[model samples]
Target: MLKPHQAKQAHGDSPNPVLSINQMNLVYNSTRGPITAIRDLTFSIRKGEFVSILGPSGCGKSTLLKIVSGLLRPTSGNVVLADVEVKEPRPDIGIVFQQPTLLPWKTVLENVLVPIRAMRMPVHEYKDRAHDLLRLVGLGDFINHYPYELSGGMQQRVGIARGLIHDPAMLLMDEPFAALDAMSREFMMDELQQIWMTTGKSVLFITHSIPEAVYLSDRVLTLSPRPGRVIDDIKIDLPRVRDVETMGQSMFGEYATHLRALFKSNTAPSTRIA
Candidate 1:
């Protein structure tokens, strides 16, 4: 476990940081009053690092991702990606949501290329990259298939392919596999690990699952309940190329247990955000 100051120092010492959140805060002006979704959040993701944000529901995990992705502006603080302050949505950030959110009418290939089309960056130029990304996500054979024809996992793979097609500097994933059944979720976890290893993209994953965070992240940043703030920065020392077998190891269980305990100790009554 690293203290907040130590974590900041460690991140500062890194040769290259892909993303940095400095004293971030977000407050929503609801009719009732001002609600703080996040408060004084600070962290950084080094280039090629896979980091996960873990917290109880309504702790603003997804909200944090939005701020980082430039979808939402924070009331205070800053989100810097590659030394550029994010004011609006930029091409350098790619986001994967909890659901695949695929266009039913589009073929898998066409859906994967949506980003390219939306960015108006010469659809033809990204066609090859789309195909390669589909292959990378194990959807090469399903390129012509529609979203309806694929399983939940397959649809999510299409979502991953779409996120990567643009070749962004970092990927922001908001519980991308939370909807899958247990067996499918477990399988997709390994699949995601392979994708991250292959692409080496800086990833900021938001999740509620301790094991999932432990399995996929180089470091896990745990947040306190709503009005979210970083409470712990845990470095996972486990060897990479992790698999189903890796989950059975003592260190794996220890990391998961430690995170679970942290959450338990930090548990508090939080207002539900609709």
Candidate 2:
């Protein structure tokens, strides 16, 4: 495993990133006391890069996503996006949570169109695009169906489509398939890869599954427990093109085992209950 400082020295000095964080720190102020979830962390993700952050439950992985999406601010550091500081929620960033969080009454097409409508963009311009996104997620025949009519996976499909509607520069996803069955979770992984390949979008995906992270990301960032900081940032050496067959290969198993052990032996306390 590469050391944290070495990883930073190698990947941090370069500059082709869509977003960059330098000496980042995040502390939650509560009535009890000040809690530091993340501390002096630093990393970068280049354009079109797929980065996965995996760690134990209280490692502040989701908290880091909040910072990147501009939903929360770092206490003493900066989050720079496309040469600008993210002071507040901007339309250019799209976020998807663990649950689908879709509007139950709206049909799939309507849900997908909400982002475009919220941005006050011409609806006509995205009508076909919306259909195209629905189709891309294998939901072409379900466009008019209401959220209640669809399965957990299908609703998530709609959520994915909605996130991409605005053509955000970056996508932040937090355990979006954690609530699904194992089979559905694997299916969602494939769907996400397809979308990422087609859109070439920069993505920061958070998950606790080592194989999932190793399979999906170009690079994986592992953090310590509370006051989480980089513990390991290893490149998945398996090939550029990943699929079921890739999972069977020895290299894939090696990487997965490596990551699994890294997390197992890691002892980071929870700053906040998840």
Candidate 3:
């Protein structure tokens, strides 16, 4: 693991990244004083690449996601998407939170179309697209089902479909499967990889699970304890179409082991590894 000073700017030399975070910093003014959540953070996500950000809890992992989605502005630095600076929420970006947050009253299909309705896009035009996305996520038959009728994993699949409804340039997922059971989480991992492969969209996934990150990412970026900054940028050379069997392979374990060591070495004493 590289020390803060030794950590190079992640993907600094990669050409044509779909999303770029340049020397980002975010501070929150509270009753106590100003708190810096992120410091000098820099990284890039290439087009159609699946990248994961791994760090201890409260290391600003989700905060970084919010900034990327333009929900929150950094105190300093910039988030550039496809050469355009993200100043406010843009219609072209999609976000999936830890919770599906699906509307209870709406059917799965209706929930998937919420973004389109909010953006004032022609609802009729996207109805077919929504059905296609649901089918892609393996929820074709559940399109008319309410959130209450689905399992936790099924609800999350709905969220994934909703995020892609607009065909955003990239997907920003903040631990989208964190709430699922162990079995469900594992299932979603494989499902998500298939979805990523099919869609060919850039993804910046945030998570605390080392195995999850290692299993899903083309590259994994580790951040330091609070006041988060990149500590290491690791490339996962494991072949794609990884399944449950792939997780048992030596290379997969090696990658997970290496990432676990990075957290142990670079994080503070209070930091907890998932």
Identify the leading candidate in terms of lDDT: 3
Q: Rank by TM-score, descending?
A: 3, 1, 2
Best by TM-score: 3
The full ranking of all candidates by lDDT, starting with the best, is 3, 1, 2
Report the C-alpha lDDT of model 2 over 19-135, residue by residue, as the tens digit.
888789999998989989999999888999898888788778888988888889999888888778887888888888899888888889999988888878898999898999899
Native-vs-model 2 lDDT? Answer: 0.84
The lDDT for every candidate, in the order shown, is 0.88, 0.84, 0.90
Residue lDDT tens for model 1, 1-274: 4333433322432456788888999999999999999999988889999999999998999889888888899999999999999999999999999999999999999999999989989998898998899998888899899999999999999999999988999999999999999998998999999999999999999999999999998988899888999878878888889988889998788778777877877783353334
Candidate with more favorable, higher TM-score: 1 or 3: 3
TM-score of each: 0.94, 0.92, 0.94
Model 3: per-residue Cα lDDT at residue 141: 98
In candidate 3, what are the lDDT values of residues 78-142, reduced to their tens digit? Answer: 99998999999999899999999999999999999999999999999999999999999999999
Report clash pairs, candidate 3: none
Question: What lDDT score goes with residue 106 in model 2?
Answer: 84
Q: Which portions of model 1 show Cα errors greater than 4 Å? A: 1-15, 269-274
